[model samples]
Target chain A: MMFYIHKAACISPQQTFGDIDIEQLHVAVDNKLYAIEPKYPHFNGNALRRMSKSTRMGAGAALPLLADNDKPNGIIIGTQVSGMEENGKFLNQIIEYNEDMLTPGSFVQGTPNTISSQIALINNNKNYNLTHVHRGLAFENAALDAAMLVNENPAHTYLLGGVDEISANNYTLDTLGGWFKKEPCPSDGLYNSTTAGSLSGEGATMFTVSGNQAGAIAKLSAITTIHSSDVAVVKERIKNFISKELPDGKKIDLLLTGENGDARVFPFYQACEEILDDQTAIARFKHMSGEYPTASSFALWLACNFVGGILNIPRHMIKRHGDLKSLKNILVYNTHKVGQHGCMLVNVA
Target chain B: MDRIVVTGIGVISAIGHSVNENHAALVMGKTGIIKGGGNFPSRYSGLLPFGEVLVSTDELKTKLNVTQPGVTRTTLLALHAFKEAIADAGLSPDELSAHDTALVGATTVGGMCLTDELYANTHGDTENVEYVRSFDYASVNLFIQNRYNITGVVNTMNTACSSSANAIMYGCRLIKNGLASRVIVGGADSLAKFTVNGFNALRILSDEACTPFDQNRKGLNLGEGAAFLVLEKESDATGKKNYACVSGYGNANDAYHPSSLSPEGDGPYLAMKSALESAGLNPADIDFINAHGTGTENNDEVESRAMLNLFGTLPNFASTKGFTGHTLGAASAIEAVYSVLNIDRQELYPNLNFSEPIADIRLQPVMDHRSAAITHVMSNSFGFGGNCTSLVFSKP
Candidate 1:
């Protein structure tokens, strides 16, 4: 196996294992959904006091939840807005200081890779580390890299993850760009909604992926990202890939969709719905994650949990078909309204 | 094991645009470091010299032959260097796409130069909403992918100064593992007040010319540039021109400081050791070393000590920071290009302005440029967040 996710942690708009269970997640009618306020001091207190909002929460998720003896292979983080919150603060200081002087702390932490680096600092991990940023495919690209690392060198137990937060200023910019939906999907049924924008959610999810299969959560089967002008081509590619990989139509057991109540990008999700029959139970995660470039990471985390039989589909998600049996194969498809698409496959033990 | 070889190299740094220009300047001990040109308030900047590019944006655009790139100066530099590298490899557009080619780019500034300018102009005016779209690091790589029509494993790695080294290392792995037949790997960075002020706030800017491994070394001088290399698998490289063969590489985090390196140089020490081990060679096999040697008070001394510990006696080693200054994200890739040049020309560039030694062990670098029968060169690039990467290239 190239990659095996041993443990996964996430902090999103939903209750992501810190404050409460999945049933207690917040319900929002507006497309904007913020992560439940994370308790940073629970992981690293001093860092909690020093770090900015995104950095603290991002670093917190990378901390191991299960294993305490085994050191992680390394840390890899994916982010679209690295330290934009701190960057905005630094810019504000520059303006307030009249170009005379400003605190370098915010500027130092403002880099896109600062979160990953800070995680390394906290964990004291000197192993192979990387930070990848590609708008919609940021986490997929990062996940793919982590998988390759485990494949190339089995000595590594990688932490592959992604984090994205909505800054006040940048969120407004997204609002102007039509990325954030005006109204959020109801908590009772997220997938049934007909809305213009996605629930704006922010989250950070990390998994300990290793090549060793002993006590592994799930095995990464394959991953492919395409930037195409036509959705039909994407469907064709997916069909062709599945045909070549599976001869007897082994069939995916679960299909994870990144439908965030946005009607425009639902066609890709519909394509997934059309390709697979009732054997594959369809699920949507954008209701919990909201919509971010790397929000597919959240879907991937949920997929792995579902495959491991550790998580049951939340009532808010769209469940098109099939009862949760021995979950085996999961295929996730995510696309932004502006045409960034990602597809990934996860296989359970 | 399949070997990965550098078949072509291109760079646009402070010294020159093309490989030949930079090589000539290095041999002649020329410094690209110059005083600021009133781009900002000079008083606040301490009159520190920087390695600003000589070519204009329009000139670079014309050279790259891009009509509507919709990118900033950083992407233009990357495109120019990438085209030269591809052409130098003698690969046509059809060959590039036919072969499994991956594009790995690194940049710290991204499109901040243009975005900053636009943001400065549009302080509060929401009329120009286009600038907001430019606030991303993926745009540069996406543009390159589109321009070259490369369709495999296109990604970007940003690890501060060691960004491109990370990119190059990833490309090397791609070829070694039979993932890609060929890979274009390197880094790009452009001048921007955002990065400059960021570094300045850390108080690491040097007023005088940077002096690597010197007792009185001050700090690094910021620069802007880009460089790239076409790496092909050994099996696929038959009958094809080879710039230099990649022998080995290693990446280690200091786990010491977020910005500063470990006082003991543990990261560099492990990185160099791992690289040598990966190459299946000893430190004695290295003919020359391109030290990270950023000339900062902390870096130069620590790197020198790391050298002394690794080789016992330093070989022909020098810091090209004097010629190109420190190009941040582009430093490692630019130095990779320099390594290929060294192996091909059998030359060792001088470490300009290195009059005195810093470390008590007193490792002396090749103070003046010299030409020899170069066989292998080891290059080091360490960056913020304790990222340390080392690359070893050999004559093809």
Candidate 2:
């Protein structure tokens, strides 16, 4: 009894939806990353101008498909930085005024719950709403919450989403924090560069989750989280949870990884790859989407599309030689530097 | 199915910093609203009196033996609230092994106060990198985890005003699912320019002492506070004194407006109804309600109407915000702690500043604290993004 994904949309570093043009997306190099330019004007005009990056990305990705469904019973948006740009700008204003004065917009955007708040405002479909942040696991935690909610109430559609953006000051600070790779690499050939840190990027992905199997694009068989510093325990738990929760004897067809340029995290993925080996097609996305807490959302998004029969994997994301044509079941694994781990099982319907 | 019960409660609002002080204030009907301090506007911002705690970080440190600095106001409040909760539960540190106790928290701003200060101190001050770590929720988790050596699942939830409610809900779920044995579920937040300006930008901050349910209720006064409750499964509570039973809880989104609730109050309505249904009790079983009543025009009317629609006639209801102002992430936890207090004492806390009734409904909030044999308390917390939640605590 797995929850199914009815409709999924993503505003990422690639052309995700609405006349998705594969060629138009800006590719990157070893140290550079960028957000895919979706038509914001199409979703909203003046409103788009007013939104912080996270708000705009979430609304653009969710509103198109979400508008057609009857008000969702619950809405949950996840983000690592709710409104970084607005916060920075507002602080800039304060610095200019010497802390004597500041405006409300900066503070409004800084609340961390602003993106979900905006989404709720637009849909007017308030039933249950939540905004979860766990540094890098923000999106996974949100998806897990949505799946659990769907399990509790089988009839309603729950929206699980994640959004964040690159800000000048924030990005600069990230670079100082040893977050991004210093060298550059082509977007399609990100892994070939052998870099250390990932380029900064931003995105939003929304999924319509339901318990019903009929008309489901794909079923989410299982989702699990781990917070252990011991890589051995992390590896064992992944194998244990997946084997226990998913149908046995079905080797995964695809493996979606949150493998940023960081070499330290490769051991965990290496452990995973050794388990399935050639049975699963390997793919990594931090080169395209950059590394953020909720970047796992993009991996899940790509898995959903693959399950939905898109059959197209971004050229820059391939990490191993496996036939994509035979993809049926996809396993997405992601981790943060602080040792938060998450895994989700996606199936072809 | 397992039942979730509240075994311990702790709070630090404007009235007092401990459970005893808060109970005394509630019973005596003493208000905590006062003029703002430091850079905050004292009385001119249409200030409704708030139930604000009267302690600075220095005072908190002196009392709690905390040595950390450059932390956010939110963390300070959280430490105070959690210490009381653990003590009230009689959960001695020596009684359990490390990782047996888990810390689950919710906050709108993890360390915005520190962030604000850092931004101001552009003079190249080499402050501890560990202090800035509080800028995110994990930092808060790390703080408590390291202090108590809690190795269990440590997580944070942020969904506007409903953040802590979700934290509480998740804590209960984790225990129900057998993920952990003992968990601290609650949140803490303090007033900062970020939130004060944010609410002001939305035109929701009250210019005077807030009057929730009043016909002229304009908006809510921002407040500072923290609250926590120890949720233990029945098996874990074999030797413990329980405060209240976590009868039911539900969360819903209005999907209406991000900043304002639905005009019909459908989200709040459904959340309350669902919570009632989950508890296997009818609305009539509710003896009192701790309303979210932020004194905002939209919240009071919509929440009041939703309550009226659910219960027909409003039960004994009041907004503690009229006393403490709104504590944002900590609001629900503060109110939850208050609800436990009222039930434990068999008394009802008054909704201060409630003078006139709104035209939308005939419901009136208790203007003065009342004493009665209370059994069940329904608490509501609605936040931006149409995030609404209702929690029911039944007397043990």
Candidate 3:
């Protein structure tokens, strides 16, 4: 389907809320990389205070794209655990209050669709609104749906987003599950090192995808996901996806991957890297955005910048810098876990 | 466009354990709401009525042969319904694991069914935190996908009560767009203290059974269970036992309140209108309607206004929530199965406990278990965050 991304907004661990800050990059000194939230002007005093961090970040990122642009007919937000921290607090309050007369503040905020619904509530755009909460491919699924919606009615526009927050307690518990490094690791060290657990990060990335090519920054060429853990099966699928998405002579300028320095799952990224063109420049984003399920959205934002020539390869992010005068087709391959894999191709306008 | 049809269906609700059992309960006019469930001990357990499943989590685990630890009741309930749905569709392991078979599941309080475990885990102790992995919003679907080795796009939706309806909608899109040939779609949410207490905190839980559309209805009764439907292209389902054709679906947001629908029911109105438009059918052609009647005063009145605004004179309509209570994410799938049964069986279930209709807009519902010329059945599911969805199922 014809899917073109017009605008992008992100709230991540780095200073990437309203715009991409390429001058300097922030590294996570601790294992958990918290999202650097921007002030939400759409929500007033109590409304902002009541919303969860994920919701605030999601609205803070999504509302700006809708401010001075074509209003989208739909909104789809994706997240692995949007209101997780609120759920934890709500449960704790239930215990403290003895399940008695408790207000609906925390309980209502505990729902996972808080972000998408809050965006709808903020903009008062009563269009098609939905939320996807898959483990790793949540953002990809949302984008796929957005593509379908746009194809159905090319005249209409849609807003898509991915958001997840860092729950301190949950991050610590995740270390027990071997999802986070036992000790704090620097951004550069976590990108290339062979560590058991990777860094845990959270972010909210929002953009407008429309069939209207006017003022488009990049075309969402295609999105594919592989649901396998077997090495051969995943490798075959990766190769097939490259050929299917790229085809003949469509060389990739930049290849961004979700490599968070985990030894067990790094092979999946390697399988993807092995199939890329020899001259393709390599880039990674987990060191900056950490290892959240929807972290691919961050990688996608970075790929969009490279496509628009808004950014050059950072020293710490570049593995093999290619000599490309103008970046064109950028591919983002994110294998969040050993079993889950996602690939997307962004064609510059 | 290739027509998407439901080849198989499965359900696990308070009223029944399987499709046949649930159908039997509907025919016999048996209500599943009871004073309290013996399991999950809470202040309202013995006081307020809830449509809790009869099967215990341990029993479900043993019956389903689930050896995986930390598998919450939500996942177990999903496993029960998913097994039945795929089996009813006569899909083999090879077919299930095929590259074109996608699974779309939805849940609201997914893994939070073990609220105590989550609370303890979220506290300081890391020792007994097995459910830490289960806390993912997509935990139920991921567990099912891994257990069944589903290779296609397996996604999970969590748009409050409208979750599974969107899931079914997305599954059909996957087929029409040539992404997946077959899509397994449904949702599951077992009763959780977090949910029950949350709803209770919202003051929307009724002390008595939920009497949808009734003037005297207080609120809704929280329910628990799971339901799934296997959808495939018409060519792929040619020789299969087809239930109903998934004709059309629509989703919209009210943009009014976080948990309440607009006074005019704009979201529900647009959702139903768009569904009809997509199905190439007029509002008058929708013969039966399965309303998202949570028995809440606001919902019944608002839904009545929306339906009246859409179809001047409403057709045979009822809210099966009276029998199943509010299943939240699973409510759509469970009601979708009921919608299929309404089309295939040519009958309509009465809205239980409903006596007098609402005062201003007195929209009478199907109050008796009787046969009807059920052709196009519309199922409505509206949830928190103003997310509303409608799915139309027609007789095959």
Candidate 4:
């Protein structure tokens, strides 16, 4: 069963949140890109004081999507890593103070579900809430859950999203673990790098999804993930998925590939490219959003608005061309370092 | 919709290391709470009681024949329970590696159980850098997936105490949606200084054994363990030993506070009502309820109020936290296994250390072990962040 995206919001490294304009893409000065945060005046001072960066970003992105006095029936969030900064602070205290005088603020705020729960608490929404924490399949899992929920209960709306944060400690750990590029590179030049790691980025994207399509920007047809390292297996799975999803011979107009600058997994993108139709426009988004687990969420937000004619596709990210007649179906494919691939199909509403 | 049934079960807690052992301990009304004694050293060693598994890390490694370096205690405990579940289901390694077999595991402290080592490594101590990559919540499931060659959809969930219940619910959804034919669902967590200290700071750690539903219940005793259940479609489990059928499940958030439930128990009421609706049954159809009674003053009273609001006369309900303490993420899955056991054995386990009921509700829990024909059992799990989940298990 398909679910519709009613409204979408994002707080990414680019100016993609309110009234997004692709012409004003924010460029990163260093290897890391930070989300452009927005002011939140609705939260009380004491409540705002206790929230971590991720919580604030998530709430900031989600609260605006809801109309006045709107309460969603559920809140589902997907986060690769949550509260890293708070966790780091707590761990530092444990080491510096010998675990005796440890404070509870950081420890309490460091849980991964705090983002989703905080959104629910702020909205006074007591509904079906859950958080998925898979490496790269996090957002896809959340979307899939939302789809199932709407399919089961057609009357209820849901707040579905993904959030991830990058702290100094997290960045250093990623660098040490070979997850970030050694030399600094411009954000727009991400796809041109001949390096092993991709630029690190963080963002939070939330959407109001339901069966109702009165104000929907896009229709989510399918969302799935396959776990395989072999390019041949992944290619076959994609072919099968396309065949199953597009049984009426409906061709895809655009394809969004999760091709970061990393050369290690470029072959997976190549496999996907080899199977796509020649007329399909192939585009990349990681260069602007940077590469992080759940970055596909930002890509989805961009696709929804781009199809809705509210945002334009940056010329540098596009590789192939499709005639702009009607601008219908778009597909997104993303993968993680450990061989988890996800695919999402969104169509113009 | 395809009917999902539990084909195999495995568990390892402070009370026992296997299903039969745990069931025996439950039938005998044996509590596992004790004054701390385990591999980890804590400042509250002599003062606080905890439900600690009685095995050392080295001993677990040796018994499991684990040769991989830097395997966290969380992974070891999960592997131990997963191996037993697969064996109980009579699934060969080849069957387990099938592309249609999905694995869904939950945990709050995956590799973070090695708190001191993680602290040292992240703080630039550099002595235990090998555990750097194993600190994420997915590390334990990834280790299991790679070790067992589970090629299908694998995911990790961390919803605090209600984690594994949600995992089980997700696995059932996968099967019903034809995403998988069989799924292994459960969770694992290990005792660590991080959790102990975190709970201590919240002032919810009871100094003595927890007494659920008691008038003077102080708080909860933190515990750690793992449990797994193999769920297969009814058509696929024709020849297998079916424990019970997963009839219904629901999840909701309180949206009240980060660590406390609302006095009205709105989330709990909605979750229970949704579960009953999904099961196509009324409140009168439920024979027993495995309450989410953490022995905390707020939880027991609020849960009682929710139950009273739903069923004017409560069922024969009790909290096994007195036996196993609060296992956090593992509590739901462990309670699920106990619920299945109650159906399979047609027995009711007693609620230990409950001498007096609360003053307001004045409701007494099941205090005597007895044999009865229980057709349906409902298990509840509520956690931090106001997440609440309920699952109904019916006799097959």
User: Could you say which candidate leads in TM-score?
Assistant: 3
Error of 1 at B212 (Å): 1.3
Number of backbone collisions per candidate? 7, 41, 0, 0
Docking quality (DockQ) of candidate 3: 0.75
- The CAPRI class of candidate 3 is medium
TM-score, ranked from best to worst: 3, 4, 1, 2
Q: Score chain B of each candidate by TM-score.
A: 0.95, 0.93, 0.99, 0.99
**Candidate 2: segments with Cα more than 4 A from true spot:** A21-25, A29-32, A98-103, A182-196, A271-281, A322-325, B36-52, B58-70, B90-103, B118-132, B145-153, B175-182, B202-208, B215-218, B356-363
Residue B266 in model 2: shift from native, Å? Answer: 3.4
lDDT of 1 at A230: 70
TM-score of each: 0.94, 0.89, 0.98, 0.96
Interface RMSD of 2: 3.4
lDDT of prediction 4: 0.87
DockQ of 2: 0.40
Per-residue lDDT of A94-180 in model 1, one digit per residue for the tens? 555644475688777777777777777777777777888777878877887887788877867878889888776556556655666
Q: How well is each residue in B40-59 modelled by candidate 2, as lDDT tens digits?
A: 43323334344456777777
Candidate 1 chain A, run of 10 with poorest lDDT = A62-71
**lDDT (tens digit, per residue) of candidate 1 on B126-187:** 56565555556777887888777776777887888899998999898877666678899999
Greater-TM-score candidate between 3 and 4: 3
